[model samples]
Target: MDPRILDLFCFWLLLSSLLRLCSAISSASDHRYALGDLVPFYANKVGPFQNPSETYRYFDLPFCPPAHVTEKREDLGEILNGDRLVHAKYELNFRQDKPLQSLCKKTLSVEDVRIFRDAVRKDYYFQMYYDDLPVWGSVGEVVDSSGRVHDRRYFLYTCVHFEILYNEDRVIEIGVATNGETIDITEDKDVVVEFKYSVKWKETNKTFERRMDKYLQQSFLPQHVEIHWFSIMNSCVTVLLLTGFLTTILIRVLKNDFIKYSCDEEIADDFDESGWKYIHGDVFRFPPFKSLFCAVLGSGTQLFMLSIFIFMLAIIGVFYPYNRGALYSALVIIYVLTSGIAGYSAASFYKQMDGVYWVGNLILTGGLFCVPLFLTFCFLNTVAIGYKSTAALPFGTILMILLIWMLVTSPLLFLGGIAGRNSTADFQAPCRTNKFPREIPQLAWYRQTAPQMILAGFLPFSAIYIELYYIFASIWGHKVYTIYSILFIVFMILVISTAFVTIAFTYFQLSAEDHEWWWRSVLCGGSTGVFIFGYCFHYFFARSDMSGFMQTSFFFGYMTCVCYGFFLMLGTIGFKASLLFVRHMYQSIKCE
Candidate 1:
């Protein structure tokens, strides 16, 4: 590979990103609106990654007030930019409880006030209740006592405020209704009057209050459609770049002869019918315990990365709710990006195994990947559409999914398929297995079975369950997108750790005269996914606090993603180890 090519590739991608950002800014001017003082205010909602808005206050009106109204008026100076002077005006509306006079014959006491406040607190939208409901809550308070003293005297005044969180897809409406209606022990019909508070912009300082509403009304806002477009462009570009890189690597792999060549035919006569390698007419087998140890290590490395990448993309805003095809979009993106690891590991394994049927290898690997994914999608889609569930992908979204597969994922995958065609390195790593193998009589029962080896991989994954829960919670409950940074780091750690652990266990297995390298490597490396699987279940049943339908959907959705990731990891590391072992065995025999 040319260093300049890599440098130039990075440079081009960076430049493209910068250009996209600039384009976003250039279009911003057209969307700007003039500020006014008397504009009517609407409730603003907070969203992931966006800051809260600090403008107009919000108060919830009852269902029976006939119509809503605003009260009180205040003008906040003006900002003069060029020919325009924007003045800000505020209004507050209060209603007197004249109708409540019929129900409340006596003055209200503190105890009644407490009961009313408690009831309202539990009943009303307490924590942007609708906005963050089912997951988290917002900041706010409640009233202590209704200040109504006599028949005509109403003692409660409600202060309301709206804290705008984000401005991405839809404007979130979060209202904090606090401090109103204080009554005595009896449940009096306090006419329960509601008030409105608002602020708007104005062109002039004089009559700013009157003009404020006009300013707000005239302020033109671009529909969420534009933002969604921007996000799509950015996501498309990123996916393209990643897909392109994978394709390049895959193409190179397919072209390489040594990497593609399988040794199964050449070595067929040398092995026993039971698939055991031999030395000096004796079965050269690795102790079962050591093999399992190696598999777990390898699998762990793969799982860590798969999880991180999936979450990172989610957190980075690429798959936000505003995007119509977020789930499918994510699926395609992750699958394509994953090809690099898959190719490297799988190809590396074939080399070790001295395997035959390169074409078979390629087909098997790709099929293993695509089948599970298609099924998962089909399942999700069926449930979503048949049930009119928000979870289903729309036709347009399905097109997006196709675009991701055809334009992004398939291309990269095809390249990986090609690259995996070659099998040159003979062994994945430089290290070679020694000849005239020293036989260790010691053997463990756990190493012989596939289940036990798989279990080894499962153990370490358990250690990291706590971290996995945080990731799940963030995605499902919080609905936050954009987790790339943390994901990248986690991936690095998983890869390095798996490699290191495999190498360590391999050394031990070798010293112990355990030559059953094939399954051992996979068992050691693939175990991580098992651990992740278990932890994911634990999170679903025990750790997660999410309630209702969301809980069920989130659990299954995330589980599907994690399970796929696990299989990929197992395939990669297991394959790599097997390849490495084969090379070592052959090298030792040739030298001897």
Candidate 2:
């Protein structure tokens, strides 16, 4: 191999090693612990079971506080994930079991009663951590078995059972059970709540490396593994059928058309012009809004690559659900690093199109996705602040993100734009454009761009909708999504289906003598996003139990951003595929 290639490979290996080292250090604890060594415990967040995003600090509900109240230092990803780990009041020792002991006894005031009552009514759950392993338990519950809103007794869970599993001296897992003492705080006068806890340590043969495997194996996932496999196989079958149909139809039709055109050129003095051949002169005409289109394509290209890299990393176990904020942190860092690709793609494409406004194109490319996302984030942050939820970003976090954009992302983007503008060649079209545009004939409503887009989008959407359900459940519900390999396969299928369907629709549009397939091709491919958004609506109302303004806004707002990204990525794929198909078709025939 060349020295340059060797150098690149070495660099990649170094980076991967560093990343793995960081991950291990972040997640794992020293296996050897001396007897009576203090094991630090941390209280994380509390939230309603139904609303995953709407979390608050663990102490928000007047929970017992630690003497010093120190917070655990967290990285950017952890903060973004809404983790707020504070020192817990419980005293734990390595390999030492504590019998049922009194943690804290407090007399509840009227205000405290109200808070506890609300939390119990909402079915709040709290999370804690010991040696990097997480434990979760419910706060309280309503005493009425029938679940009647009126005349119900509010019972607070005041005791905890901690089961710690150890492999030799290494702590492997921590389990929490809240089915302990319950005290009724039905009246506000004077209710003394005594909080208690017991610790039990047991030996296990499981290695420290496999400690997190338990959290990944949720009971719900085991039961649904067959369904997940079936869904993936169904999507694979869809792709194969779609691919076969498109290949067979396009091959037979194109062959006949190619033979007919070649024969006519050989014999006829003046061959009758019809179908796609009639508008060959104007087919390569530059579309309107060149700058915006180029910017979109550029951003789409960057997103496309970013997604692939993230998925590849996930498949290789760089991050998992147990690793709090690792995936999101990777996404943010990779996106920042890849900003240059967006600028370069846009600038190069714009240059090829003979566009003069280089600076404007760069600016547009940089802002195309960031601007909308920033605005949405601001709005959501405002809502989070209003609700005093942990989802709201801190001022410092926001500043850090801005600094990253201004200092790092912007400079890389400009550098890429400069490189692209200087290095790229002029756009080469297989056929020359005519000075006068060809007149397109009117067609039936079903053949129109909108109708074609709807039809074109359905196939790709159908391929992924089933997978989308599990994804939504994982994100919005308590389900763990550990099947990245299957997800990666489905993603590939979705891309293939989108490209093939978009190309077929483009062919149909061109056969109708419509040379304005530039934007139509993109729209046809991107229409899957609209379908995805529509599915979001169905999921929100019909499937999810999510309610309240905060949850509703969060669900729809973030989903819109997701669907828009899908639109851009798939749209770019479609346009590129159709472009290739058009060029090959025109180049193979005598279009002069």
Candidate 3:
């Protein structure tokens, strides 16, 4: 084995062990504190309750500040997730209960009142952490006593109550109660606002290892579980039916076609020159814009592998809701590492197609996905900056990502392209192509690419539509998605459905004497993304309470990129499956 390969394998092992150790340490009661030892309380972020993605710095609001504030160091993932933990003024001692204590008192000016009123009206909430356990509290609330929209009162919660549950010396859980003092912020006058907090330590039998169990079940309601199971069963049924139907039809059709065309050489000349056999020469012809198709397929392959690895990690409990920033961090790192796969796949396919511009193919492969992603990121980042939201990527973080791409991703991609160009075999079609191009007969309305693509995409889209709803809720709402096992199952069903549907469509197109199945198969398979994007619209309008320009733009903008990713991933799967189907069908028929 190459030393570099061995070193890479060792590094992977080390990384896996570190992740496992971190997960174990996070849940274990390894950190013990004596009585009177200071327990640092860190304020995280504040955001509108309706929009989880819209978050701002804890101190963004005109709140009382500490004498000298310090920030808790965070990893790349945490920063990317907009987690800015800062030292809070609330003082707490482990195992030491404190009576109601004044944190800070300040006279709220008109501007402060306006800020508080707006926050209260928007139902803004704040988050904090103690002993790595999270706690949430609302900034204020709007009470409509008169049952009229215009007759509303905005009240700010001035006092916060913290209850810390501990097992022995380790903190098991932290809860925040906001039913303390409240003051009306409806008035614009200067008001003396006093922030107070009380800490009470309670003993619990719950072990430290089970400390995160509550959070795991925080959003896993009975109804949600039922819905998830229902979706999975529904998807499985669809896949079984669709697969059985496609298998039976394709087998019967291909069997007859094979027997008819496989007549002994003496009788083969009498057969009619029609059906898919008529287009054998054109079926394997390189599609137009070969570089783009290859690049999309390559990127799709990379995304396909990336999704599988991430979901597998999730299924094995490497990623959980409590592990802040870990999932996104892993996604970034894994994607960067997998850039070489995209390069290899794209370059090899292009080379096999007798492409000469290997360098251009490599560049297209790298940029096909990243270019759109970068543009979307820039748009979203601009909106975040305009709204003063923490979702905006910091300049340093952006620079770091670019550096990773430049230093690691780009080189690996180039090396993979080189290896692929050197090692890949030439295109070997079972049937030789004629010098003149074959004219495709006029296709019927139903046989046209548009209708075929729509029909092809709907089955795969239906298979995962229910699950998409839950996923959207989990991502955009407060619901936590912990059912990775079911998600994985649905994902597999989706892939199978896409492949079968694409192959069936390709067969139909070929039978119609349209040998342009290359791009058609890819488009048909990826059309599921179009349906998904359409569903995003329905979700935005019918399902969610998300409004305003920022949230709306952010939702649709990111969703476009997500749907595009689905397009590439599923399209690649379809194209590969169709390619094999075409090769086997043509090869077995004893084409002339």
Candidate 1's TM-score reads 0.49
Q: If scored against the real structure, what TM-score would every candidate get?
A: 0.49, 0.95, 0.95
Q: Model 3: per-residue lDDT, tens digit, 108-133?
A: 99999999899988889999988788
Error of 1 at 351 (Å): 7.5
Q: What is the lDDT of residue 491 in candidate 1?
A: 44
In order, candidate lDDTs are: 0.39, 0.86, 0.87
Number of clashing residue pairs, candidate 1: 73
Worst 10 residues of 1 by lDDT: 75-84
What TM value does model 3 have? 0.95
Taking the tens digit of each residue's C-alpha lDDT, what string does model 2 give over 1-592?
7744553454464356447534535555565677778777889999999989889999998878867789988777789989998999987788899999999888888899999888998889998888777789999878776767677998899999888888777788889888778988888777888899999989999998888789767624678879878888888888888888889757898887787666765564566668787788988998999999999888999999999988878887777555777777778877887888999999998999999998999999999999999999999999999999999989999997887777667777888999999999998887888999988899889989889889989989988888899989888898888888888988998899999988888888888999999999899989999999999999989998888899999999999999999899999999999999999888878887
Per lDDT, the best of the predicted structures is 3
Clashing pairs in 2: none
**Model 3, residue 468: C-alpha shift (Å):** 0.9
Query: What 10-residue stretch in candidate 3 is worst by lDDT?
Result: 21-30
Which lDDT tens digits does candidate 1 get at residues 1-592?
Answer: 8744553454354345333332322112222122221223322222111111111122221111123343322111000000111111222111111121121132334554443343343322311222211111222233345554332222333333333221222222222333433322234444333333322111223331121222222122123324334443443443354345434533563233223232355664454322122231222333333322322332334344555655655555444322222343334434555544444444444444455544455444544546665686677566545534334444665664455444444344445545654644553333334545545456676544465545445433433343454456545443333334444444444454444344435434543446555455655665676667666667767865444343355357647766666655654565455455445543443221
